[model samples]
Target: MKIGLYFGTFNPIHIGHLIIANHLAEYSDLDQVWMVVTPHNPHKQKHTLLDDYQRLHMVHLATEEYGKIKPSDIEFKLPQPNYTVNTLVHLKEKFPANEFALIMGEDNINSLHKWKNYEYIIENHDVYVYPRLKSGNIDPQFVNHSKIHWVDAPVIELSSTFIRESIKNKKNIIPMLPAKVWEYVEHNLFYRK
Candidate 1:
């Protein structure tokens, strides 16, 4: 099986995240796409993040209806400030029979050099890069090579920061998030003041 790992904090999985994962599952060559809900993102701020379990549950709610897009909690057991390289290595060991690919946005592709052991990641994994809204064609050196694919997934501009801010400000977030996710947020009062 060819599995595409879509890594993210998914602070609260929004439509944009879902769309990218769905594209990888249905449109790309990937057999399935798993949204790897990270406990912490090394490159990002951690102060405002929801608890890892909550974030994982939110991802589950957001993707429940999508059979092709599954939610993963593999990072929860991994060390803090999880690095993509380490997770890929661990997953490869655990699921030896399955071929794994990396799923990321074009914006992430632009910052590929900054990631931990990014060279190894590029060399070993088949990467499916989706487009980000307002982002022009970003061609990194690694993308010029084979195995790294630039996917034409639609650009959905929504961000978790915007979703959290909207929730904190008591703005309607139903349009930005899935119905189950929005309901879970409202019921749990996540990201509220």
Candidate 2:
């Protein structure tokens, strides 16, 4: 089976995340899209993140009804400051029969060279990139890679950081997240300042 590994902090799962996953599953050749819940992304700041388990649970709640969209806790057991190449290697070893691919945004493409063993990842695994609103530039090296494919999905302006801030200010996030997820966030006092 071919799976797309969608890695992110998902401090709280939102509608935009779901939309992208659904889009990839429905329109792309991927059979499944796993939302790999990262404990801490080496590239991102830690202070703004929620607890890894809580974020994972939110992903579970948001994607519970969709069989193709799975919530993964693969990174929780891995060492801190997760690296994509290491996660990919571990997943391949664990699921030998499954073909794992990388799912990322065009914005990430710009910084591909900075990631650990990024060249190896590009050469070995398939990459499915979604367009980001402000990510106008793409790395030439990424463009030259044979395994990379660009996917077109609606570029929603919503972001987890914005949603977190909104929740802190008691702003309505009904439209930003799934109904069940929103309810869970409210009940759990997520993003409360």
Best-performing candidate as measured by TM-score: 2
Off by over 4 Å in 2: 41-47
Question: Per-residue lDDT of 1-193 in model 2, one digit per residue for the tens?
Answer: 9999998889888899999999999999999999998786566766768778888888999999998999999988888776889999999999999999999888888888898998889888999999888887687777767899998887866899999999989898799999988998888887888
Clashes of each: 0, 0
Model 2 quality (TM-score):
0.94
Instruction: Tell me the lDDT of candidate 1.
Output: 0.86
Best-fitting candidate, scored by lDDT: 2
